[model samples]
Target: MTTDTELKKEIAYNIRAALPKATSYEDYRKLVLALAESGDTTGDKTVSYINYTLLNNRRMKRWDKTLKITDEQMKGIKAFSGKVIWLVLTESWCGDAAHTIPAMNKIAELNPGIDLKILQRDEHPKLMDHFLTNGARSIPKLIMLDANSLEVKGEWGPRPAVAGKMVAHYKKEHGKLTAEFREELQNWYNKDKGQETFNELITLLALENVGNSANL
Candidate 1:
């Protein structure tokens, strides 16, 4: 379990490092509730990510990447000239990354007009330059673009001019997402609840929650 001190420091670092749009306390509340609702009895983090994402949001997984946009989908995206792009830089093992990628898939499901992509941060270090250099290196940045004009519209956190908003909001409202929260979130990632509600959410998010499911 992470200590409160460590959690405080990381939360502070996240505030300093990221720039997210000033989300309504509603957004944070839903996010936290979704995470809390997603936890597993077995104390596993991976299972939690899958369950939380499915229950609360949507996203998809690619071959090696737990959360990604498929090649066939990319081909369809690039074919057009002016399209909005929502790209997330992530890797499956990353804690934040695990949360993010699947969320994108869910977004895609809700709004087919938008386009989504997932890039591995380690594989493409250059991508990090776009969001945040901070070591927090939170995974799964949400990038958006105008589908018709193909201009970038928005993104989630850690970018220049972006971290300020997240900082301003969290400073006033969040009071640091506690270690207990992280612990609970981590718990959701473990074990097999095997509930259909959880599985359906995984499918909507395009997440491979069941590695065994892939075998079939």
Candidate 2:
């Protein structure tokens, strides 16, 4: 079996190569528009779906301006005395990515120790396969690693806890992730105001401190 450390080293190697080629959020915004205007059927309806996700992300980013962390979250961030890398697997068209990434960006901005990098999910199949949610290739999955050792500290993703449960309940009742369910999910994000996502991440990051015996 590939040990966890070995797997993370592989993931870090892939990330180093992909970071240079990965598109920025602005660049991805342009690509989504270009894909929509191309009039090509190469990806069929995927282009249209991505276009919708891009637009939704724009809205979420704007609304994410009010993201604020609690005192506890600040303390958790402060406990990290070493540099950490936040390597995230995402795509421009993932609805969950649209809703969650802006707040993540904000969190990274709060701490100089945290360096954030985004890579497209489809482009990193093996890495994505390792972080599957319910055996699905879920987007917006994130892995936290030690900058020096490249050890995987913890991971979180796809959606915040409350929103994830909402999705589960919706899928259970509706039999699929339909448009109605998606709209409801976004609505929940709007009301939550990124609190759940931020809280979850702070908790995840705190685990890293506990592992290192940092004063928390």
Give the number of the best model, judged by TM-score. Answer: 2
Poorest lDDT segment (10 consecutive residues) of candidate 2: 35-44
Each candidate: what lDDT?
0.42, 0.73
Q: Write the per-residue lDDT of candidate 1 for residues 3-94, one digit (tens) a residue.
A: 97876465444422332322322343345345545552112357654564444333222211343444544443333333345555654334
- Per-residue lDDT of model 2, residues 167-186, tens digit only: 88888987888877778787
lDDT of 2 at 198: 84
- lDDT agreement of model 1 with the native: 0.42
Off by over 4 Å in 2: 1-47, 214-216
Please give the TM-score that candidate 2 achieves against the real structure.
0.81
Cα-based TM-score, every candidate: 0.37, 0.81
- What shift in Å separates residue 172 of candidate 1 from its native position after superposition? 14
Q: List the residue pairs that clash in candidate 2.
A: none
